[model samples]
Target chain A: MNAAVLLINVMALAGILVAFMDDREKAILSIKIAFKGFMQILPVTLIILIVIALFLGFVSPENLSGFIGQQSGLGGILLIGVAGAIMHIPAILSFPLAASLLEKGISYTAVAALITTLTMIGTVTLPLEIRQLGKKFALLRNGISFVIAIVIALIVGVAMEATLWQ
Target chain B: MAISSQISNQQNLKDWISFGIVLLIAFVFLKIYPSKTGSVIEYFWQYTMEMVLILPAVMLIMGLFSVYVSNNMIEKYLGKYAGIKGMFLSFFLGSLPTGPLYVAFPIASHLLEKGARVSNVIIFLSAWACLKIPQELMEFQFLGWKFMFLRLFFTVILVIIMAKIIEYFFEITDDRL
Candidate 1:
């Protein structure tokens, strides 16, 4: 709901600010062009969301959840690393997913890493991103992001764990 | 700039084909995924208002950007030579965009067309989607400050390095492609 509202307010401001500039006709035309682009993608966005949600509802995050939430041991770090590689669910959905994970005894560090990776990495979106942007770009970006997200999770987990837990 | 009518036509054809492919895939998924089989009606209603509002706004916003934000302005400022100033600009501009992922993807193509380097585009898209400040704060409210800030700080640095790595690869690939 907050996201929806922020999206609205920002859109209005963007519109009004642009509308004030020289060339009203051009402004209006550009807006229409943008609209066409938006319409073109609406169906796909909704479809992707539904497909992802279905993956959520049926597939179950439990087994992997257990693996990724380990606080110590190389096994935990490795599980967290793999989890970081494929976290493509959108940001909005991660909340409910995180809440459920906490209830299920998942560690905050793992959940945090998963949530960050959910937005950070894009294995699911890789093929599409590749098509649009090119394969080398997609592979490089996602691969690097996957590595970085894992490192960040480890560092953050250690820092917070030491300060808060000890 | 006399953009070839043929080029636009070719792009249109490509867009249609991609859309058709995705649409077909969507239908197939809907068939196999029975859970959401009949839920379109509810979804249509729930998303209708938000869709209507967002569609126009996204259009206008993007239109304004493409039209008003001059290509040279982007290049002269954020192009390879602009250094830290360009990087900061890319970060700020990238963080401002909104929409579901679908809206973001093609606009990314448009940005690339408009003189944005692969480095800037990938970084912008990644940061726009993941490293957004507002989204971070919201998560902080839900999760905790530590989780949010740590992710942001790391993501920003990670994005810079990844962007550089991608830039290096593309420099090599362009020679071949």
Candidate 2:
């Protein structure tokens, strides 16, 4: 396997072993929690995977690039930023999807905005957040997050092009 | 608690329904474009393999931390540490393997009840939402270190600023918590 996979496996192995050594009961509970968490995310994972596959398979690079490509400009970034905030897919899967789009010539700014907003803002879960933390805090947090995501993406895109690509 | 459980149940039902709809769409697409099925399946398999290897381990780490590290522990750290130290500690604690943002909301409310600093609470909530360790690892694996690190650095800085601004606003407006 690749280094990422290898390192993760080792980390998990070490964590499991340590937990088992420390407390058998807790270790068992951890395993149960792991299983429960796995099941919880499974459907979403499958959905994201299939959707990504279809998206990449069908959407031609020209079409993909034309919309979010390097020259697609600010409107494209705004479109994606809104989409990211609204969509509630697990953030982990977003990286690969972002990478795929980047490879397809989508601007780094757009992808960065997508990832930042995807993680930072959750329109779908706003009700739960408001109920838990009050409307003011929830609205303020998410609203600020959306604005910052765009700023971060713009800065990142410029920095990457200047330093990394050069 | 009854209401919370009901909300979770409804959430679960929505998830399964969305899953079914996505699966149906995929099936329809496959049937319509038999020629592209191979490429679609190939992409699906590639992502599945990556996630199958990494996701469970990530979840296990999250579970271990969640089960072992109590809310009391979080409150103690975030409550005691003050100023810049407290802010850093809030970020650190929030970055640790934990549950989703919703899970952090209740914890944040509890911290507010215990009189945690508004800035620190905001940092805690923001970090819990985005800067999670496992989430970072996944980003690193897919998007490369440069992408991950740059985004992370920018996020940390902006989140701190945003938190402070929001806290100031809250202080001036309502003196809320």
Candidate 3:
């Protein structure tokens, strides 16, 4: 495994050990919770894995890059942002998908927009949010987030471009 | 609790159905293009292994945080603080690895009902949605540190601004009403 993965595993193990020392019952409960979470996410995880495989296998880099590459410009980024807002998936899984998109020549701007909107603006959860936080607040938060997601994407794109040139 | 469990059960069923459909599609695709099967499996296995390696650890961290960092503690902390300190506190509390964004809705609403500032509550919700610690780790693993850090930096700055703007809108609307 990579250092990042190793570090994460070590940190988790250390945390669990510390928890066990502090309160054995709570530590056990934490593990139970962790296991339940793992199970809960497993099906979604598998589906994403297969989808990624299909994407890589079937979708040509040329076609993908044509749609979301550097030349695709603001329109592509906006399209990606909207898609991200509408699509519902675990944030963790989005990273791998983003990486895949990047690998296939999708612009950093588009990927950033996708990740930002996917994480921030949840169209699927909008109704629930409105019910809890009121219609005005929910709509405003989501609307503002969508706009800012595109802004962040543009800035990220420029930053990455500068780094590459240097 | 019963209603929530039922809702979760329905969600679980939906996930399973989606999973089965995707599996069938994958199988059909492989059958249609036997030559591509090898590459498809290779990609699937690579990503699956990468995900499986880190997910358990990530979930463990989330679980520990959920159990130890009680919601009442968060309310106590964020409800009392105000101004810049409150914003930072909200970011910190929201960043703590916890359940999904939906789970944070109630806590955020409670904070508001308890008289937390609109900007702070918005920051809390936004941070919970995007700036989550575990989610950041996953981003770091899949995307490089530069990508993760840059996005995090921009997100923090912009989310704060957005929150303030949202708060301003609320104030004006409240005044008009």
Among these predictions, the greatest DockQ belongs to: 3
Which one wins by DockQ: 2 or 3?
A: 3
| Candidate 1 reference-contact recovery | 0.41
- CAPRI verdict on model 3? medium
Q: Output the number of the lDDT-best candidate.
A: 3
lDDT, candidate 1, equals 0.60
The TM-score values for the models, in the order shown, are 0.57, 0.94, 0.97
| lDDT by residue for model 1 (A1-166), tens | 5554465458557665657676777777766766765555444445444444434444454665555555445567656556655654346446445544554556666766677677766676667777776676667777777777677777776766676643
RMSD of 3: 1.6
User: Which portions of model 3 miss their true places by more than 4 Å?
Assistant: A164-166, B1-4, B175-177
lDDT of 1 by residue, B12-73 (tens): 56555665776677578778877765554344344444445444554456556655555445
Clashing pairs in 1: A34-B59
| Chain A only TM-scores, each candidate in turn | 0.53, 0.92, 0.96
Select the stronger candidate by lDDT from 1 and 3.
3
**Pairs clashing within candidate 3:** none
Worst 10 residues of 1 chain A by lDDT: A48-57
